[model samples]
Each structure stands twice: as structure tokens, then as C-alpha cells.
Target: EMVMPGDNITMEVELIAPIAMEQGLRFAIREGGRTVGAGVVASIIA
Candidate 1:
């Protein structure tokens, strides 16, 4: 997904366990193997 500087990108993942209680996951958005943006998983329980 292409995101503008101020635009937002949203993602969701489902796991058997609650991700918030366990160690968080790491993710990075990169271009040409150079990181443009990075973040950890945000656990949203619904």
C-alpha cells in the first residue's frame, strides 16, 4: 500500500493468543530495503 506522508494505513491480524499480553511483534515498511517507517503491533480487542 502506498501512503502519503500524512495519510494513514491500517492493518489487522488475528492470532490464537492475545498479542497484547505476550511480547509484541515488529514490523517495518521499507522501500529498497531502507526503512521508511516502522512500528510495533497494536493490539485492539473487539
Candidate 2:
């Protein structure tokens, strides 16, 4: 599903990061080989 602008929700995700992520880490949200949006790491669970 597509996330609309101004939406604040918590959901689980998986990523391949070059660096370890912590609170406040930001990343680009990619789809179909292109970036659709951006997001920040709110928490990490592993």
C-alpha cells in the first residue's frame, strides 16, 4: 500500500544499510528501483 503525505504510523520494515541504524537515522524509501519517499528510524528491533 502507498503511504500518503502527513501520515504518521508505526510499521515494521527491513533494510540493507551500510551503517548500523539508531534513533533519528534517516533513509530513503525506495520502490521499483527509485525513491518514493524518505523516513527516519524511530526504533530498532532485532
Candidate 3:
């Protein structure tokens, strides 16, 4: 996905199974050698 500079972005994921069983996920938003932002998958159970 393309995002404009200085814009806020949000992401979500739904899992059928328990998040504990999963190794989790990783994300990286970068521009060349610089990393603009990053995040990790958090367990949010319903």
C-alpha cells in the first residue's frame, strides 16, 4: 500500500486460532536506509 508523507496509517489482522500458537508478525516501513516506522503483531482476542 502507498501512503503519503506525514499521514497516519493503521493495520489490523484477524486470526482464527490463538495468537499464542503463532510466532507473531513483523512489519517495517522504510525509505532506503531510513526506517519510517515499524510494528509487531499483538494478540487481541475476541
Candidate 4:
């Protein structure tokens, strides 16, 4: 995928994991075979 310097980008995600109270789940986003963004899900309950 080719993205311009000022292009607008949107992404969707689906997380399916066994999360406990206050548990942190780590995630990362890759672009051009490299990690560009990363974050942690502080708490998620289902």
C-alpha cells in the first residue's frame, strides 16, 4: 500500500483474548514490514 505524506488513513481491529481485571495486553502495528506504532490495552472485559 502506498500512502502519501498527507493522506488520511483508517484502521479497524478485533481483539479476542482472555483478559483479567487490570491486566495489560500489548499490541503493535506494522507498516512496510516494520513496527510503526505500539500500545497496551490497560483493561478490557467481555
Count of backbone clashes for each model? Answer: 0, 0, 0, 0
lDDT of model 2 at position 31: 82
Q: Which candidate model has the greater TM-score, 1 or 3?
A: 1
- Give lDDT tens digits, candidate 2, residues 4-46: 8888767798656766779999889778999878888988788
Model 1's TM-score against the true structure = 0.38
Candidate 2 clashes: the total is 0
Preferred candidate (lDDT higher): 1 or 4: 1
Best by lDDT: 2
Q: Taking the tens digit of each residue's C-alpha lDDT, what string does model 4 give over 1-46? A: 7665556555445546653434466676688999876656655544
When summed lDDT is taken over every stretch of 10 residues in candidate 4, the lowest stretch is 14-23
How are the candidates ranked when ordered by lDDT, highest leading? Answer: 2, 1, 3, 4
Give lDDT: candidate 1, residue 8.
Answer: 66
Superposed by TM-score, candidate 1 places the C-alpha of residue 46 at a distance from the truth, in angstroms, of 10
Candidate 1 regions exceeding 4 Å error are 1-23, 44-46
Q: Candidate 2: global Cα-lDDT?
A: 0.81
What are the per-residue Cα lDDT tens digits for candidate 3 across 1-46?
A: 9876776666775645654533366766578989887766555444
In model 2, which residue pairs have backbone atoms overlapping below 3 Å?
none
Please report the candidate that would top TM-score against the real structure. Answer: 2
Which of the two, 1 or 2, has more lDDT? 2
